[model samples]
Target chain A: MKSIAIIIKKELRRFFTDRRLLISVFMPGIMIYLLYSLIGNFLFSTPQSQEYKIAVQNPSATFQTVLDGYMQSEEVKDTYSLTVIESDGQAEEKKKELENKELDLLVIFSADFDEKLALYMQGVKPEQLPVMQVYYNALEQSSQSIYTIVTTLYDAMESSLANVFEVAGGNVATESDGFAYMLSTILPMLIMVFLFQGSMMMTPESIAGEKERGTFATMLVTPVSRSAIAVGKIIALSLVASLSGLSSFLGVIFSLPKMAGMSMSGLNIAYGFGDYLLLFANIIVLEMLFVALVSVISAYAHSIKEATAYSTVLMIVVMLVGMVSMVGTLPSALWVYFIPVFNAVVVINQIVTFSVSALGVALTIVANLVCVALLVLLLAKMFNNENIIFGK
Target chain B: MEEILRAEHLRKTFKISAKQRKIERTEERCKVAVNDVSFSAYRGEVFGLLGPNGAGKTTTLRILSTLIGADSGDAIVCGCSVRKQPEEVRKHIGFMTSELKLESFFTPSYLFDFFSELHGVPKEKAMQRKQELFRKFGIDRFAEVKVGDLSTGMKQKASLVISIVQDPELIIFDEPTNGLDVLTAKVVTDFLIELKNMGKSIILSTHIFSLAEKICDRIGIIVDGNMIKEDTLAAITEKRSLEEEFFALYAQIKGENL
Candidate 1:
């Protein structure tokens, strides 16, 4: 225990005391925050929160009665205005304005007699539904709002024709499920990436750097067991990497609201504290796996620079495996949980989406820790090899 | 003098890859680094292994220090088998080599405490010994400065102080005065004499004939991984000048290699 503590203390001192290393550890999180903010500002600034404009052609008396009933609410009045124009030329002028971003929407209805609708209502089926053309530029936010508002008013039309939508069965997707799906896909992939990055930043220096600078030989000459040294470093590096991963995670989580604009409400996460506990537990295991794997690469490498290069290839491979689970598609087999980093990533996705099974989560944690143990053992064995440690 | 260290027919070979050899193309290869060399040192005597560079002197010391294992055979350091009880062997040895570098980021003072703790010395005793060694070696003057930022001599003194933190029964110094300025070299030589007087079994490997003559009670001349001669300084220098005899032996070995 004393030997392990001494080793961990020395490693932490080297890691925390270097200002350049401190910056490198924090840089990924800061960059992620800036990137998320920039994307949110660019795409969803909610341009010009203005009232809607709707142009209507000739309308039937029945439609007018329905519209009046739908527009009785005061909030509806403040958000939208109906301008009914009978002349084709005038409606065409409004359609042109809609395209130019001046008007919000244009609604054109075919010339209709009330007798034609009455006949159709009396079990007389028409070959086609009455023509209604709704025009709005999808790019403009106000136009989109107008489309949604006008469509909502015409929901009365759907109620009149009960056979149309039929509004059947429970919806498989909740309104919040969209946000959960997004979180599940994006965060796990990013978590895998940032965890790897954080571990890579320190492992190469802690292991390979020591070997290169000849400090490792001195440490080896001590009475401390090689396994003790390897275990101490693995735990210490895992902690530092976990800290870095958490920083980036918080940056992305906090910036998600800003990135999503008014729809940030979707991200409110119905997840309770238990889900967060599961998420954090998975992250801790993942950090251990990553630190162990990177330490192996560092041990294999002759120098810190070579270790960094080797770790890049490892990161790319891990990210690729992590990407495989990014879509949150159910695995083809339960045995997929046996694969190391990929299984952890899938488990993270499951946790975020609130779709994880207790059995599957347990399997993932066990498999990941198994990998970490194997890697640490391998590193200890490598430390005993003079050629590997002193080859450079 | 009691026998404190003995190495019996220790051997080590390394496999070099083509990429490591920097050749365009080649098969895997092996190089014999240490070839069945053996020597012994007593409880209170300085034994020197005199050799040219690449003559496996460092490899022999590394084996005795238990930094590496011998391919075959073993060394007994202070009654501990290097192969079977390496950790025990290491606990009784203090080794300073070109390969055991002080971490540059730490101050000499921090490293002193750090290495002392690593050596398992109790804190109070560790500090007392650290102060004594630091003051003795003049390392206290720059003890607070980072080792990397210190002058070469200061770093060397700091390194030596850290090496002997446990005050082991056996001391191995490989080319102890290799890269020091004259003043620093003299300091190291003097310090080594002091260590010898304290009754530690010391093994110093060096190619400088004078360093071997001045400090070593017994010297072994090694060439091409072979120990050609071993004797007391007086017995070895009896017939001819040490330098002339060394050149004649070196020329014959060079001719054989060619």
Candidate 2:
């Protein structure tokens, strides 16, 4: 234990003594914050609906009145500007215009749409079900938004004919800016990405660098157990790497409101301090596992450059694993906690969304600890092997 | 003089690929690095292993220091068998070589302190030793400077200081002054003599004939992984110049191999 403390102190001193390393340790967070803020600003402030151009064919009084009312009701007026096409030839020309990007959307209502709807309101089925042909170019953002709004408008009109009110998509849940949802959705990927990257940044330098510089042989010659040396390095690396991960996470958290938009009032990103602590614990464990794995790879390499080459490939593999978070929330399972990089991603996702289980967190920690212990043993064995330690 | 280290026919071999084999193209290969090597060094004595590169001089020292295990026989250091009690051997030995470079990022003082703790030296004793050695080697003036920033001579001095910080009973140095200025070389030879006078057992390897002629009390000439000659320095240098004798023996071994 005393030897381990001395080893840990030495490893940590190497990390904290270098000013350049200190900056690099914290640089990822500052950069991630800046990057995410830029993306959020772009997403939040970029043109949502830039005056969608729509052509209507064969407008009816009931449909017109409902559309006009919706257009005037403080939401859609500035968004949608409409033109009426009287003839079939004109409707065809408008369709061409919509395809050519001259128009954002086009709606061809059946000539007897209002008439058939009135009959339908009287409990009689209308012929052909009052077909409405909607046209919009999928390539245009404005057209997509207008399509959803127009479809909602028609649904409202059809419901009014039956003297019933309906909500868009029947999802009466108030529209959210998805601020908290965004955190839940994106935070896991970010955390996994930064944790792996942070471990990569320093782990190779600690183990392989020592081997290359011949410092490791000095340690091996000492009477201290090789296991103590490996443990000290892994513990110090995990702490340092977790700091980098935390830096990135804090960057994203502080910049989230700017990304969720200032206009989105009461955005519920209601994760308490305990939840963050859980998330940080998960990050620490994940960092430990990754740092140990990277250190082993680094030890296997002949030199720092070779270690870096091997770890670059491992880094890519880890990043690909992080992509599992982007596949969305997984159904909770005991098996979910058994996957290495993925389990931490899942747990962080659970923590952010407030759906975590006590059991899942425990599994993540225990599973990672087991794997880390196994890896540290492997490193100790490596320390004993002259070929590995000397990189002969 | 009390014997401090002994090797009894220590042997080791390494398997290698026959990539250089042109005719047979067979991969079966092995090189016996240490073959039945035997030697001993005593307190108040400097035993020098004199050989050209790859002659197994380093391997012999490494075996005695327990840096590697012997394949056949064993070495005893301070009454501890290297194979069964390597950690015990390590505790009583200070092994140094160009291969065991101090980490460049560390200051000399920091490295001294680190190795001191690792060797289980109490803080106060380690500090006293550090002050004594650092001042002795003139490393005290730049003890806080990172080794990478130091001159080559300073780095060599720093390596020497850290290795001896434990004050082990047996000191193994491989090619101790292979590359150093004349003044620095003099410092190292002077230090080895001082260590010998203090009743420390020292095993040093060098191919430089002049270095061995200057300080070694006894010498062994190793060739092709075997100790071919062993005698007092005065006995070896009785008639022919040591340099001429070395080449004569080297040429004789080469003739035998061919």
Candidate 3:
């Protein structure tokens, strides 16, 4: 145990004292936070306030009332300023303005449109009921948006005039459920990737780099047992990876609300302290599994470069599994929780969404520990293998 | 004399990959690295295994040091069997070789303490030994410098100091002076004599004939993984110079005139 402590201390000192390594450990989190914030600001910022220019050949008071009623909503009230211009035998010129995007919309309402519409609703149909022509440039985003809004209002007005039945919809999910659903989908993939990346940052260089430089043989010639070396390295590396994972976790958590265009204050936070405890416990165990497995792969490699190449393949595999599991339905089977990476991802997803079973969590933690033990054992055995250590 | 180490028919073999086979232009799948090689060293004596490169000198020392396993034999170091109790054997011996390199990032002082802790030396004893060895090897002036920054000779000195941090009874050095300048080579040769005088059993492997004559009490000539001769330096040179005798034996083994 003392020897293991010594090894752990040395490994951690190597990581923490090196400025380059320290930067690598913290850079992922900082970069993620900045990039995600920039994306959120660009993709989900509130619609910009703008004015819409409309040319109406024959302006209708009824249509104006419809637009006014729709604009009363708080979200749209301050977003758009409306202007009405008479066509006055310049319809072609107005179209030219619309084409150039100088005009937002052109509405040509027939004379006596309200009267004809009233007559039509009273079952006295006129020769060709009053018509309205709507034209706007599709090439301009603002013009397209206002055109859609205006057409939607007209459709509603037509539906109300000849209404036989009404349809309405409401979301049954609470605000907290919405937030949880988003987290359950996104955090698993990101966290799994971040945890893997964190392990990759240290394990290959620590194990395989030692081998390449011939230092591993020096360690082997000592009286320390191989298992002690393996355990010490895994524990120390897992601690480092955990720090990185935590950084990324914070970045994700703090940036998520901004990305979704929702105020974090508006969120109905559903997770309790116990939920977080379970999540973090599983995460730490999962990192151990990752570190152990990477150490084994690294021990098999002759150089750090080779180890990194092999580990990149494993990283891709991890990413594919995480991404697929994120979109697929969660498995409730007890045996599913006994798988390694997949199990941890599922358990984390369930924990965030508040549907995790006690048995699943227990099985996942047990499975991760078992896998870690097996991989560490394999690593120790590899350390003892002369060919793997000395072979070209 | 008390026996410090014994080897009975120690052997090791390696599998040649297809690429290596092509490079060497050989059809054999396996190359015997050490074939029925056996020799012994006594306490308070420096034993030399004299051979050209690829004569299995390093491999034999590696097996005895417990860095590798023998295929069908055993070596006992300080009364511990390398085959069965390698960890125990390692505790009884100190091994140094070109293959065992210190981490470049570590200073000699830090590495000394690290290896000393690994060898389970008491803290106070380790500190005293570090001061003595560092000063003796002239490594004290650069003890705080990283291994990578040290000159080749300085690095070798540091490695030598670290190898015996446990003060083991037996010390096995593979090619101790293979890559040193004349001054550093003499320093190392003098150090071996000093170690021998202090009652430590030393195993030295080298190809230099003069090195064998200078300090070795006994010499074993290994050629093609076989121990061709083992005797006191005086007995081996009684009939001819060590170099002339070595070539005569080599001709006899290869069935050619030299």
Candidate 4:
């Protein structure tokens, strides 16, 4: 225990003193905040334009009336200035124009649009009878306006036809832009990246760097147990990575609203001291797991460069997994709850959305602890292996 | 005299994969690295294990220090079996290697204190030991400088100070002065002589035969994982000069091979 404490102190001193490591930890969060804020400002402040070329297919008089009404609406007039074409082929031409940066969007009205419009309002949704298809090649600011215009037109047509057909009003739900949604989509990926990056960049240097410098051999000859050395490294790395992870979490929470242009009035991100402590505890366990895994990776390599390469590949894999989890819902499985990186990502998402279950939190904590334990064991085993320690 | 360190038929073999002949179409196997060997060092003596690179000098030292376990032999250090009581063996020895580099982030004083504490020396004792070593090695004048910023000689002095801070019964140094300049090497050599006078058992492994002649009470010349010669310097250099005797031994081994 004493030896482990000493190792931990030494490691902490090294970490605090290394300028490169200190910069890596803080720079990512600052850059992320700055980039997000700039992008968000552009998203919210930019005016919508409707220089979109759209095609009308065999337009009837009533269809023309509806189209003209949309063109005249203040929201539409403020957002878009439309150019109507004759056919789908012409719409495709407009799509090519948009692809070549000539147009913003392309809208196609199919031949059966009038019939489909009638059916769409009469409570019979037209899946194949395409009333309009808007195409934008990229995620541009104007695309949001295009989506808004299309949805508004569809809703108007539906309500009018509902009156004629005497059908029940189909109330459509709008998407939420509050804390829960933001937490679900962005927080998990951010946490995973922060934790993984911190571990990848710090843990290897703590172990393999020592070996490369020849300090590890000197360390082993001390009265320190192999287990103690491993534990010390794990603890020091966990502290560093967890602190960086927390910094990143705060960066996202504070900068996200400004970036997304979403109202922060109803967003209750202000947590009590107790909530902060709990969050910190979770992050600590996750950091320990990642750090231990990195230590094991460091032991596998003979030099700092080799260790860095191995750790980079591992971080990329973790990031890819975290990203996939962000874009989709996590699978509910007991086994999934046991997987280290994946479990951390899932729990972080749940935490952000304020939907974390007690069972899930407990499971995640236990899973991470298990991972740390196994990795420390592996490291200790490696330390005892003559081939590794003696560099044979 | 009591044996401070002992290895009996110590062996370590590493299997290498090779292509098999036509009939088997399987990977053949060959054993590489350390083979069976044995030697012992008595208390209060400097024992030299002389070998060129890849002659298993480091491997033998690792086994003795409990850094690694031998494949099929037993080593005892300070009366503790390395195979069964490695922790105890580790507590009795200090190890330094030429490849082991100092952490540049810490001052010499802090580095010594850190290791003293790791060895479970009391805080007051650790401080006293640090101060004493700093003064004795003349490291006190620059004890506050980060090790990385220090000269090579200073770094080596710092390394030795940390290694001996625990005052273990046995010390193992593998090519401890391999890269030092003449002045730094003399300082290290003088320190080793001082430690010897204090009755510490030391094992110094090096390919430099002259280093062994200077301080070693006994020398074991190892070649191809085998100890070809083991004796006191006086006995080995009975009539011939140390250099001539070393060449004669080398020539004898070469002639046997031919």
Please rank every candidate by lDDT, starting with the best: 3, 1, 2, 4
The recovered share of true contacts, given per candidate in order, is 0.80, 0.73, 0.82, 0.84
List TM-score per model, in order: 0.81, 0.82, 0.92, 0.79
Put down candidate 1 lDDT per residue, B116-137, tens digits, no spaces.
8888999999989988988887
The TM-score of predicted model 4 comes to 0.79
Looking at candidate 1 chain B, the ten consecutive residues that score lowest on lDDT are B19-28
lDDT tens per residue, model 2, B96-167: 887889988899999999999999999999999998988877899999999999988788888888888899
Scored by DockQ, the top model is: 3
Top TM-score: which candidate number?
3
What tens digits encode model 3's per-residue C-alpha lDDT throughout B1-258? 898999999999999999999999999999999999888889988899998899999989989988889999998889999999998998988988766889988899999999999999999999999999998878999999999999877888888889999999999989988877887787677778778778788999999898888888999999989999999888999989888999999999989996
lDDT of 1 by residue, A1-392 (tens): 99999989988888889999888888888888899888988897535535677778876676566656755655454345778997989988998899899888888877764555666778676666666778999989888876776677777665675564466588688657766777777777788898898798789988999998999898898888999899999999998999888888888887776676635566676988888888898899999999999899999998999999999998999888778766548583689788888888778888887788878878889999999999989999999998787775
Clashes of 4: 6
Which pairs clash (backbone N, Cα, C closer than 3 Å) in model 3?
Answer: none
* Model 4 C-alpha lDDT per residue in residues B64-155, reported as the tens digit of each score: 88777788889888999998988888788888876776778889888887878878788888888787878988999899999989988888
User: What's the lDDT for residue B51 in model 2?
Assistant: 91
Candidate 3 regions exceeding 4 Å error are A56-63, A69-73, A77-99, A106-141, A151-163, A266-268, B179-194
Choose the strongest candidate by lDDT.
3
lDDT of each: 0.83, 0.83, 0.88, 0.77
Instruction: List the candidates ranked by DockQ, beginning with the highest.
Output: 3, 2, 1, 4
Which window of ten consecutive residues has the lowest lDDT sum in model 1 chain A?
Answer: A70-79
lDDT (C-alpha) at residue B59 in model 4:
80
